[model samples]
Structure formats: structure tokens, C-alpha cells
Target: MQLVRWGILSTAKIGTQKVIPAMQQSDLCEVLAIASRNQATADEAATKLGVPRAYGSYEALLADPDIDAVYNPLPNHLHVPWSIRALDAGKHVLCEKPIGLSAAEGEKLLATASRHPELKVMEAFMYRHHPQWQAAKRLVEDEEIGALRAIQVAFSYYNVDPKNVRNVAEIGGGGLMDIGCYCISLARFLFDTEPKKVCGLVENDPNFGTDRLASAILDFGTGQASFVCSTQMVPYQRVNVFGTEGRIEIEIPFNAPPDLPCRIWHEKEGATNEVVLDVCDQYTVQCDLFSSAILNDTPVPTPLSDAVANMRVIEAIRASASSGKWV
Candidate 1:
């Protein structure tokens, strides 16, 4: 099989910490090139990650004829513009989430994506593609957790630094945009529908003038979902699904490694079972999927449309938080 050549748009921390490593681990993927604004940084990342080529600028890497896709790990503010640029350059783009700061922002990007039927553009919500997540969806659909009625998810990590993007307001910074998005996305995924209502709260960071913590409640028609997302708490996360008959619990749901699964707790009819699964490096799985999609003309499952709904809920949450009322 011819490998799908990948060109990373930036040498960002996430590229080093998770994405690049995952790409290197996948057989169908090849890290052909990486670009940093400065050639030296690009060269350093290329050398460290064993990528064959490095470019001094984003434009140069996008123009590489051999590169079929671009993995955009750029900052939140750069995601939309860079992703459209990648698509315009005739390269498929797998962008990191949240794809945009607001629903309209996502819509604009989707408009650009509409022009590129030949190219795929998607947000990199790796968890959605993980096997365990597949299992979770199956379990819910199979009636293991019959008649889903509620979902509770939390994704939070302490962000003591005010200068980082997570705590800045100007560059689309806030806990909601940075990480709460995972909770918002996952809830809707399990429900398999857009939320009907969104209401949320936030704890402010005086130093940065950004929301350090955010929590939201969503009504999904048959079930109600509540999520607490933060950049100001001790690290904590969970994704729990409840039905009429039983419930399944995931201890570390959102950012779980595909190899290290969130434990599942099923309880019903006076019986309880504990399931421990291993699902680590979903990022690699995602990279492999993107690579194969581009190389084989296969449809990429998680496209911009998948993320637009999530962003709409996020926008509503921000609105709810600001207005101190339901949205």
C-alpha cells in the first residue's frame, strides 16, 4: 500500500506530545514534512521526530507536492484560517479542536470546505474514532444501557499560567474553548443529536480576564446532559451514560489513551459488573485514518459538519455563561 504522506503545519506542543508520535506509530501514515515559522525550529522538530523534510514556513509545507494532508496543530485562533489555506492549497486538513471559537466561525470554515469536495477537512476529535468510543456507542445502541436518559461528563485541568492560550480572551481563549469542548462534543455524540438547550456558568481568572472554569447543562430531548469543564481545578474527567435499566461509567473518558481505557461500571437489576479496557493512542488511529482516507479516496468520517454542532453548543454555553440564564 502506498503510504499517505503527511505534512504537519506547526511544531506545536501537541504535535510533539501526542500527534507526531501517533503518526510515527501508524503504518499507513508517513510524516513527510513539518513546518515551523522558523526553519531552525522546523529542522529541530523534524530531526527529533525522524520526519524526512522540514520547511521554514507554513506556505512552503502546504505547497509540497508530495504531501497529501496537513495535520494542523496550530493555536485556536489560527485553526480556521490555516485549515482553509490548507484546503485551498489542495491538501486535506485534519485540524485540532475546537475547530472554531463560535458557530459562525465554524460555518465560515465549512463554507471553504464546501468548495473542496475533492479534499477532506475535519476537526481532530480523536476520541470519537477510538475503539472504546465505538464500544460505548455500541453498548448504548445495543441496549446494554437501555433507553439513554442522561449523560454527565467532566473535562478539567488546572491552568495556573495566565499567559497560555487557555486563559487568554483575545486569541479565543477560555476553558470552554480549550477543553470544555471535549465534554460538549462527547455528550452530543452519545446522544447522537444536537442539544435543544444549553446553559452554563464560569469562574473568572482575574489575572487574564478569561474564564478559568466553565460548566454547562444541556437538554437532549429524551435525556439531560450536564458537564463541568475547567482550567482551574485539579485534573479530573469522566463520561457516564445512564439509561432506564442501567448505567455505564468511564473514569477518564475524554482524553483517555486508546490503550488505557476508562473503566466501565454497569449496574442494573441488583447486579453490577466492572469492565476495564485498554484504549491508548487514539491519535495514532486518527492519523492512520486520515492518511488512508486521502490515499484511497475513502470518505473521512469526522468532517467539519461533525464539529459544527459541537461549536453551536459551545457558543450557547458561552452565551449562557455571560447572561447568567438558560440559552
Candidate 2:
């Protein structure tokens, strides 16, 4: 309970470059091992990360009694199955975002977590742990932005490589599933309500068989959220919230740089103010938070139920896009 012994599920770049290092930097987490399908890959990752152990197969890492938890950075399609396997092996899990392909799959993950109530299972939406987002939420709740009205989110990046897992349809690749989920989760977090209806427009890559661009509107009854996400557009990301008498804008909404100051701009009545937060590594905060939750038997910031709610909206968006009708 003093320190959470961690085992990484893969040698994914996200893990090797970002999440793992962030976790390693936390005093509450000790990344003891890393695994990859290829032994040499795992060994190399372990050496590079200063991890003491390496395993050729994920099962070997899961079987290690020393590892109390796992960081599942596997492909989107492998998330649920491997997370379930980890839970079955008595290890807590911090799975990557979009925890499941759909709401039904998310429900299954929840059911699995329910059976192992002692272990903590969380979706790795690292941005939620960032101080800037926390500050923005506090300001919104304090009504500095007045009554909430609407939210606009834009997240895109140009990546057309057909060989990348994100561009493959069979592995659950799409702009909505990849980056759009952030838009949905953020809207839900700010409004503190689920969307009553949703409408979407989608365009797929003919050769890749995955959605490259998408626009969606989420109706929250009292408020609305609109977003555009693409895998083949200029690199850009931002979020703006409009209220009855004021508005707030997040200069670096998603995928914020860990070393740069985060800014939140607020405008009200004829006055404008900017709040600056010190640079922070959100992934480390996320890991430490989860570790504390496990050691203290408390709740994680983003639970499996939250993942289900987000996935529900995502499913609705897909439905609306396909049927050419609001869903």
C-alpha cells in the first residue's frame, strides 16, 4: 500500500515516451516491469525506462505477484479483453481512453470491475487531472462564466498513415473514437449532465475504412455542445465555453504540453482576465491519484461508470451519423 508496483502492458510509444515516464516520476508508483509481444522489444523498453523486469508476453507480467497494478496502453481493440484479463489476475488497471469500443463493451468492463471491488479500475483520461482543467471547472462551478449555455471544441491532427493502428477500421479507429471522445467527455464534465440527443456528420477514408473527419452536436436539454475532430486536418485543439453573461476559453484544451504554462481566458461584462497554471505532467498526477485511491480505498477521478456514460454519447453519435437522423 505504500507504493504501487506497476507493470506496463505494452511498449507503446505513448507509454514509453509519456505515461510510463510520468508514472515513474511519481513517488507513489514504481514501474517494476514492462511487457511486449516481442521479447527484445520488451527488454529494450525495460532498459530504456530503467525498469527491472521484462516479459515477452503480457500474461507473464500479469502473473508476477510483485505487480499490484497494470497500465494498459494496448490498441483500442485490445483494451477491454486485456483489462479483463488483468482484473482476473488480481491487478488494478489504468486503461487508456475510450476504454471500450461502445457502451455495451464499457458495461462489460464495469461488470468485471464490480466483481473485483477491492481493485481500482480507471480510464486513463490524463487531461482531466491537469490543473488547468481543474481550475476551469472550479471557475465554471463558481459561476464566473454565469449560467452555462454552450461549448465548442475542436481537436484535429493530420495522420494519414494507413499502417498506423488509428487508421485501421478493424481496430476501432476513427476521429470520433480517437479525439472526439475528449470533446464528449469534456462537455459532459463541464455540464455535469448527459446529452438528451445527438446529431452527427461523418466522413470516412475510402482506403483506410476509418472515419477521418467528423462533426457532432450534443443536446444537453439545458445546453448544447458541438465539436469537430479529424485525423487528417491541420494540427489544432481548443475549447470555449459560453455562458449567460460570460465565456471562458482554454488556450490548450487537450493534449496540453507538460512543460508549458496552461492558460484559461475569461471574459465577463466588459472585463477579461487570464488564469495561468504552472506547467504540470497530468499523467503523473493521474497515476499518483490512482495509487492513492487504491492505497486509501477511495474513488478514482474517472470511474468505469463515467467511461460508460461517455461511450453512450459516442454510440449515439455514430448512430446519428449512419441514419442521417438525430439519435
Candidate 3:
């Protein structure tokens, strides 16, 4: 089996502490190098993670001829620009989501991607690759939950450090962009369509100028999805899917632990059935799938258009919050 050589763009916690380790475990992925703005930082990360090479700059990593793909876990503002650079350098890109700061920015990346038909690009929404989600999708399709009617998601964590990237408003740090995007993405994923309209309520932090609490209702024509996300609450995450006859509840939806079994509950006729999925790293599954697509010249599981669509919903929700009307 040919492994796709991967270069990481940053030592961001998600990459170094989570994604990089999982990618290292994948049969189809090779963590060839990692880059940071500072050579010493890059070198330290490389030494710690067992990556083969360390580059002082992202450009140097992208310029490597042996690197077949790039995993971009840069800040929200840098996602599009760096991914475009990687594409221009003839490397496939797997960028972390919300793909860009806005829908227009995402569209710009889409145009860049269109110009490179030979290369593949994908937004890293790893939760979608998990078997537990796949099982939930199948149950909904199989009518085990009757007719899908609504989805309610509550994702929150407590973090108020002013220096934390998530608290900075200038570079796309907010509850919505950070964790709420998952709610929007999963709703669209399960509904298998974009929302017709959306209404939102956001509460921004006075000091940080970023949203600390947000709630929204997405009208998906056939059904509705509602979600609330927070940056200053007890750390909790869950997703519930409701139907005419029954409901399905996902436990620990977004941050499923790789070492523990994941479970979802199906309720019908006053009885609940618990379904548990075997342990697996979603990050490994996601990276391997993208690498396989590149090696086999196949379409990515989630397209760039999906990222743009999800961004539009996010923008619309913000607009609705400001205008006090559904958008």
C-alpha cells in the first residue's frame, strides 16, 4: 500500500496533540514534516512528535517535493490563504473547519480549488467519519426512528482566557465558529440538505468582543434543527434527533474519545435501545479516507461546496441575530 506523505502546517493543539498522532497511526498517511513560524518551535514539535522534518516556515513545507498532501490546522483567517498556497505548490489539502471566516472567503478558496482539478481539497469535519454517526445516519434512513423531524444539539465548554485563540474576535474566535459549526454541519449532514431559513441569538463577551453564547434554529424545509453553543458553561456536548415515532440521542457527539466506546440511544414505544460502537480514532479515519481519495483519484467524502454551504448558514445566522429576523 502506498502511503500519502503529509505535511502539517502548524503545531496547533488540534494538530500536534490530536490529529497528528492519529494520522501517524493511519496506514495510508505519513507525517513527513511539521512547520511553525519559528524554527525552534518547529524543531521542538518535530522532535516531540517523531516527524521526519521541521520547517521554519509554511512556505518551506509546501515547497517540499516529496510531500504529497498538507494538513492545514492554521487559525481560521489563515485557512484559505495557506490552503491555496498548498494547492499552488501541487499538494492536496485537508483544511480544518469552518473553512474560512465567511462564505465569500470560502468561495474564494472554492474558485482556487476549481482551478486545480488535478488536486483534491477537503474541510476536516472528522466527526462525520465516525462509525457512530454512520450508524445514526443509517438508522434514520432505515426508518427505525420513523420520520426525521428535528435535531437538537448542545455543545459547550468553559474557556475565558483572553489570550486563548478562541477568545480573540479578530481571527474568528467564537462559540459559533469554534464548536457551533459542528452543530450546523451535523444538522446539514443528517438532513442531507441546506436549511431554508435560520434564526439566531448571540451574546458576545464584552471584553473579548467574541460570542460566548449562541443559539440558532435552522429550518430545513422537511424538519427543523436547533442548537446552542457556549464558551462559558459546564463542558458538555450532546445531539438528539427526534422523529414522529421515536428519537435518537448521541452521547459525546463531537469529541468522541479514541480509547472508549461511543454510544447512541434510540428510543421508541417507551423503550430505549443502546448502540455502542467500537473504539477507533476519528482523526485516523478522516485522514486515511482523504489520503485514499488522493491515491485512488476519487472524490472526497465531503466536498468544498459543502464547506461553503455550511459557512452560508453560519453567516445567515449571524445576520439574523443582528437584524432580529430569520435569514
Candidate 4:
């Protein structure tokens, strides 16, 4: 099997602590190098993650002729710029979620990708690769829940660190960009289409100047999806899909633990059935799928256009919040 040689663009915690390790376990991925602004930091991360090479500058990593792809886990503001650079350097790109600071920025990356027909570009929404989500989608499509009518999601965590990237405002730090994007993506994913309209309510933290709490209702015509996400609330995450005759509840939807069996409850006609999935690391699944696409000349699981669409929803929700009207 030919493994894709991957170079990580940063030592971001999500990559070093979760994604890189998971990719290391993949048969289709080889984490060849890691890069950082500082040589020492890059070296430390490369050694810690067992990557073979370390580069002080992102440009150096991008210039590596052996690298087939780049995993960009940079901050929200840098996602597009670096991903575009990777594409220009002749490498496929798997960028972190909330693809860019706004829909316009995501479109820029999409445009750059279009100019490079040979390269694959994808926004990493790792949760979608989890089997639990796949099962949930199957159940919805199979109508085990009888025509899907609604989806309610609640994802939150208490965080107030002023210096944290998620708390900063200028560089696209906020609950919506950081976590709420997942909620919007979920609605589009389950519905298999874009929302007709959306209304949102946001509460910004005075100190951080970033939204600490947000709730939105996405009108999907056939059904509706509502979600509330917070950065200053109890740590919890869940999703419930309701239909005319039944419903499905995902027990740990977003952060599905790799070590524990995941479960989804299906209730119909007052009878509940539990569907349990074997332990699996979603990141590993995500890595292999992206790698396979690169090796096989196949489409990525999620396209650059989808990333732009998700960003448009996010922008609309913010617009709705400000204008006090559906958008």
C-alpha cells in the first residue's frame, strides 16, 4: 500500500494531541514532518509525535518535494492562507473546520483550489467520519424515525481563558467559529441540503468581545434544525433527531471517545432500541479516507464548496442576529 506522506503545518494541540497520533495509526498515512514558526518548537513537536522531520517555517515544509499532503491545524485566521500556499506548492490540503474567518475567505481558498485541478482540498469535520454519525444518517434515511422533522443540538463547554485562541475576537475567535460551526454543519449534513432561512441569537462576552453563547434555528423547508452552542456553559454535547413517528438520540455526538463504545438510541412506538458501535478513532478514519482519495484520484469526503456553504450559513446566522430577522 502506498501511504500518503503528510506534513502537519503547525503544532496546534488538536493536531499534536489528537489528529497526528490518529493519523500515525492509519495504514494510508505517514506523518512525515511537522512545522512551526520556531525551530525548537517544531523539533519538539516532531519528536514528540514521532514525525521524521521538522521545519522552522511553514514554507520549508511546503517546499518539501516528498510531502504528498498537508494537514493544516492553524488558527481560524490562517486556515485559508496556509491551505492555499500548500495547494500552490503542489500538495493536497486537509484544513481544520470553520474553513476560514468568513464565507468570503472560504471562497478564496475554493477559488485557489479550482485553479489546481490535480490537488485535493477538504475541510476536516472529523465527526462525520465516525460510525455513530453514519449510523444516525442511515437510520434517518431508512426512516426508522419516520420522515425526519427536526434536529436539536446542544454543544457547549466552559472556557474563559482570555489568551486562548477561542476567546480572542479579532482573529475569528468565538464560540460560533470554534464550536457552533459543527452545529451548522450537522444540520446541513443530516438534511443533505442547505437551509432555506435562518434566525439566530447571540450573547457576547463583555471581556472577550466574542460570542460566548449562541442559538439558531435553521429552516430547512421540509423540517427545521435548532442548535445552541456555548463557550461559557456546562461541558456537554448531544444531538436528537425527531420525526413524526419516532426519534433518535446520539449519546456523545461530537467528541466520540476513541476508547469507548458509542451508542445511539432509537425510539419508535414507545419502544427504544440501543445501537452500539465498536470503539474507533474518528480522526484515524478521517485521515485514511482523505489519504485514500489522494492515492486513488477520488473526490474528498467533503469538498471545498461544502466548506464555503457551511461558512455562508454561519455568516447568515450572524447576520440574522444583528438584523433581528431571518436570513
Candidate 5:
């Protein structure tokens, strides 16, 4: 496959710590450009990541004729616009999760991307690519857990820093947007179907004016998924799935940092079967998949079409919590 030259749209912490490193490590991709709202930061990142080009503005990177793909690690508010910009510039995009404020926003972005047949836009949910998750999916399909019927996923971390962007609603800060999204996204992937309805409860922080903790129940066609997430709690992440005859549990960080290792348990013939997977870099897998989609024109794993479904569930959760009634 021909190398896809990648341009990162920001010097965000995730970009510096996960994505840039993964792209550099991927043989199918190259870190061709780095851009930031700040010129000095862009230059610094380009030098640090060994990217060949640096730009002070997002548009400058988009205008680069050589850039085949773009990574939009910009803040949540800019996700849709920047992704649209990249698509219009004829570049495939791998955008960070919560790519829109609502499902409608994601739909609009998808529409914009659809106009560019030569381009593809995908949400960056790197955990889905981890070997641990792959094993979990195989176990589910193998009926190690019998016919899957229910699931529970949780991801929370205490970000007590008052100045952190997650505590601010204006910048898309909240439990539902920050960590809860993992639960929602995972539910869709685990169930392999969109939730028909959702019920939720939210507890907002008095100091931050954002929902610091939230929980939701997703009603799939044949099963149910319960999700709990927070940004003002002790760090925790795990997933459990139950079926008619048995169950499976993946005990580890299920999202956020990629390449997390997890253990699975299966109940068969009145006995418990368990296995642990080796830790793998989920970010590298994510980059690998994105590059494959670009080079081979294969369908994106988590396309904007499906990502919008997760956003809709989140919107429903927010509505249910705010209205004190099912949405």
C-alpha cells in the first residue's frame, strides 16, 4: 500500500501522546505535517514528531496538496467544522470521538463528507481496535457467553483540576461527553446494533455547572445495556456481558488510553473459563485501520453514520435526565 501522508490539526495532548506516535510507528502512514493554532507549538510538534511540515492554521494544513489524510484532534467544538474542511480539501479524516455536540451535528458533517466521494470521515474510537476488544467480540460470537442478552460498561476518571477543559460545558465538558461516550459507543459495538431507546440520570457539579456524573440504560432490540461514567470520581473502567446460558467480563480500562489489556470470563458447563490478553497499543491499531481504509478504500470501521447513532443515544440520555421523563 502507498503511504498515506497524515497532517495533524492540533498539538492536543492526545495528538502528542497517542496519535502522532502511532502514525509514526505505522508503516502504512507518515507524519507529513503538524499544525496548531499556535505557530510555535506546531513547529515544536513537527520537530518532536519528525513531521516534515508545520502550519500555524488549520486551513494551511488543509491546503497542503500532498497531505492525503488528516487527524482532527481539535477541541470538541471544532471537530465538525475541521473535519468538514478536511473532506472539502479532498482529505480523508480520522476525527476524535464526540465529533459533534449532538446527533444532528454529526449528521450534517456526514452529509458534508458524503458530498466528497473521494474522501472518508471516521470517528476516532481507538479502543475498538484493541486486541482485547477483538477477543471479547470473538468470545461473544463464539457463544462463550451463550446468546448475549445484556451488558454493562463503565469508564470514569477524577479530573479534579478546576481548570481542565472537561469541567467546562462551553467546550463540551461533562461526564456524558467525556467518558460516558465510551460506554455508549461500546454498547453499540458490543450489541452490534443501535439502541432503540435510552433512559438516564445526571448529577451536575455545583462548582463546574456541568454534569460531573451520569448513567444511562440503553434498550437494544433483544437486550439491554447499562452505562455509568464520570469525571469526578476514582479512576475505573470495565465491561460485563451476560447471556442466556453464561456471561463474559472484560475487566480493565475499556476506553480512553488505547491498547489496554483486559481479562474475560466465560461460564460453560457449570464452570468458569477465563483468559487474559496481552496489552497492545490501541492507537497503533487505530492508525493502522485508518490508513488501510484510506489506501484500500475499505469501509471505515466506525463511520460517521454509525457514530451519529451513539450521539443520538447521548442526546436522548441528556433529554431524559433534564426532563425527568424518558426521551
Candidate 6:
């Protein structure tokens, strides 16, 4: 494939404002078409985003032979279903995070992706592709943080729109499902292991019937990862990896800025060091990596199986919260 022709499944804000523009910046791919529930809406997005084609329905976009791949930014509940539909249509997929509402649902989607081995399916965890994260991983693996002991991550933002899809529980709305997944994913990435046990605490929004504030502790045998995520708290994001000999702190860990340098602070034995990374767009890196993988028959950065593993940990956390005990 000289260049992958891409189609977007929804006119989601994240697509219009972030990923699409980032993908457009990648030389390996071109976003040719976009779809929305309404024709006018799709057309508006196409014109605004400079896409060449617009379809009123997702199925129409999937049917277009010109589209070789799809970016599924549909709501959480629609992720697996729409991704499966695109896969059946012979289009590779890059679905947004938390690919399913639960582990069982994620498993079914994973099985579907498995059957279509010719196509690539990846979860859109844009952060993992950023240089800052890559540097952090190298430092940890190099023992710059000494022997990793624990990890701390937090991602939160205040969203009070009751009518927004994120505030509706019936559609898989919650902090844990929304931003909390970042904490869980990063923990697993840095530790390079899965948790043996977990515990959690969550406070729900009675009116919305969704978790507003949540926290979890994942015991990874060799280390422990703890995080707090909230949709009703002050906006903040940070990650810290603690080791027996030192620690590394990431200021712009998750939602890194594309226009400014990102840095990691390391402290050890009464000394400190800072690693500076150039201004970079993680979404662009993510799209380019996936496109290159597809073109060269290499491996994607974040595969569907990895999403299933993260979902399993997420399910365990929810279970622990419900039972008020370790799970």
C-alpha cells in the first residue's frame, strides 16, 4: 500500500479536533472520507476538516471501496460493534480507547479481529506512542529508576454537562471508562506486567448513574500501581514511577501538548536529572506507525489483544469496587 486511504466512522469532536488533523499530518495516510448520522453534518465536517468525501451513515463510508482503513471514534458502547462492522467490510481499524464496556464484550471483538488476520486492528492509546513515554520506558528499563517499586498516575477533568454522552451511564459513561483507562494502561506499560490482584473505590453520580470519582490499586507482584481518576474534580494529569534507588516524574504524561517540549524529571541519591523531548504530536506518530505497520506487514503498537488485557484489569477493578474487597 503506497498510502492508506482512511475513513472516519463518526464526526466526533476528538476526530475533528485531534486525531484527523494528526492523521492528515502523516505522509503514510490520507483521510479521504468521513461519516455522520446526518448528511448535512457529515458534509459540514468534511468541508471543515478538508476531507474529500462525506457519507451520511457509517455503513456507507465502510462500503466505499476507496477507503482501505477506518478510524472508529464512536462512543464507548458502539466501539466493538462498529469496529467489527468495519472489519467485516475489509477495512483495518483504529478504535478509540476502552474498546468495550467490559471484558466479555472486548473478548468478542478480539475474536472478530483475530478472524480477520489480514486487517490490522489497534486501540487508540495515543499516549503510548509519544517520545516522553518512550523515554520514560527506556529510563525504567535501564534502571534509571533503579528497581521499580510502585507507580502513581492520575487523570481528571471536570465535565458537568449532564446531556453529554460521557455523563450518561446507559451508554458506558464514567471516569473509569473515560480517562481512568489511561492510568491503568500506563501502569501496565511501565511495569511490563499484569496485576495479580486489585482493589478500588468509586463514588457514583446518582442522577447520571455513573462513576464520577474512582481509584484503584493494582498489585503487579513485583510492584504496585495506584491511581485516582475523576470527572468531577479539578483538571490535572501526572504520572510518577518510584523505584528503590530513584524516581521519575512526568508533568505532561497523558494529554501532552503538540506545540511545546515535554520533560521528565528524575531524582536519585541526592541528585536530579531532566530529559527534554521536542515538541511532538503523538496522534500523528500513532497514525504513521499504524500505517507503516500495515504497509510493511509489521506489528501495530497497541493491538486488540492488548486492549483485552487492559479490559480484564478494568473489570477486576470494578469488581473490587462492588465487592468492597480485593479482586
Indicate the worst ten consecutive residues by lDDT in candidate 5: 253-262
What CA RMSD would you report for each candidate?
1.5, 0.9, 0.7, 0.7, 1.7, 0.9
**In candidate 6, where is summed lDDT lowest over 10 consecutive residues?**
297-306
- Residue-wise C-alpha lDDT for candidate 1, range 1-327, written one tens digit per residue: 688788999998999778988888899988899999999999999998899999999999988899988999888889999998998999889999999767788888999989989988889998888766877888888888789999888787887776677777888888888888888888888888888888898888888877887788999889999988778888988888899998888766667764555676777766888877665588987887887788778888776888888888888888898899889
* Candidate 4 wrongly placed segments (more than 4 Å): none
Candidate 2: where is the Cα deviation over 4 Å?
Answer: none
lDDT, model 3: 0.96
Worst window of 10 by summed lDDT in candidate 1: 253-262
Model 5 Cα lDDT, one tens digit per residue, 127-192: 888877787788778887788899988788888677877887888888898778888887788788
TM-score of each: 0.96, 0.99, 0.99, 0.99, 0.95, 0.99
Q: Report the error of model 2 at residue 198, Å.
A: 0.3
Off by over 4 Å in 1: 258-262
Model 4 earns a TM-score of 0.99
Clash pairs (backbone) in predicted model 4: none
lDDT preference between candidates 2 and 5, better one? 2
Model 6 over residues 70-161: C-alpha lDDT tens digits?
A: 99999999999999999999999999988888889988888998899999999999999999999889989999878999999888999989
Give the per-residue lDDT of model 2 (tens digit) for 204-250.
Answer: 99999899999999999989999999999999999999999899999
Which model scores highest in lDDT? 3
Tell me the tens digit of each residue's lDDT in model 4 across 105-182: 999998999999999999999999999999989988999889989999999999999999999999899999999999
Whose lDDT is higher: candidate 3's or candidate 6's?
A: 3
Question: What TM-score does model 3 achieve against the real structure?
Answer: 0.99
Residue pairs in clash, model 5: 259-282
**lDDT of candidates 1 onward, in order:** 0.85, 0.93, 0.96, 0.95, 0.85, 0.93
